[model samples]
Target: MDSSKIINIIIALFLPPLAVFMARGWGQDCIIDIILTIIVFFPGMLYALYIVLKD
Candidate 1:
């Protein structure tokens, strides 16, 4: 509902890794996201949302 949340969702929708990347940093997590996205569609999306929204 807030601007930060909205921005995070938008970022996640566009590029899932970016959400986690922003939350944590540009590192192993981004690699994990890419692997998840490759293995299962939307898993990375949900993961990103969880990380961003959980905070």
Candidate 2:
């Protein structure tokens, strides 16, 4: 993985929504990440990692 991806993954483990925002910007994916974070933290982290890795 690239350094940026590693950094994003690290961020995702901490602030999932922010990581998603960094990866996808202010859009649906970010919104979903925020919502998932609000609902549950781990799922949000997983989702953020998925978003970061998917691209």
lDDT of 2 by residue, 29-51 (tens): 99998999999998999999999
lDDT of each: 0.84, 0.94
Q: TM-scores, in order shown?
A: 0.75, 0.93
Once fitted onto the true fold, the runs of candidate 2 whose alpha carbons sit more than 4 angstroms away are none
TM-score of 1: 0.75
- Give the per-residue lDDT digits (tens) of candidate 1, residues 8-52: 889988789888888878888778887887888599988888878
User: Native-vs-model 2 lDDT?
Assistant: 0.94
Best by lDDT: 2
After superposition, the stretches of candidate 1 with alpha carbons farther than 4 Å from their true spots are none
Backbone clash numbers for all candidates listed? 0, 0
Which residue pairs come into collision in candidate 1?
Answer: none
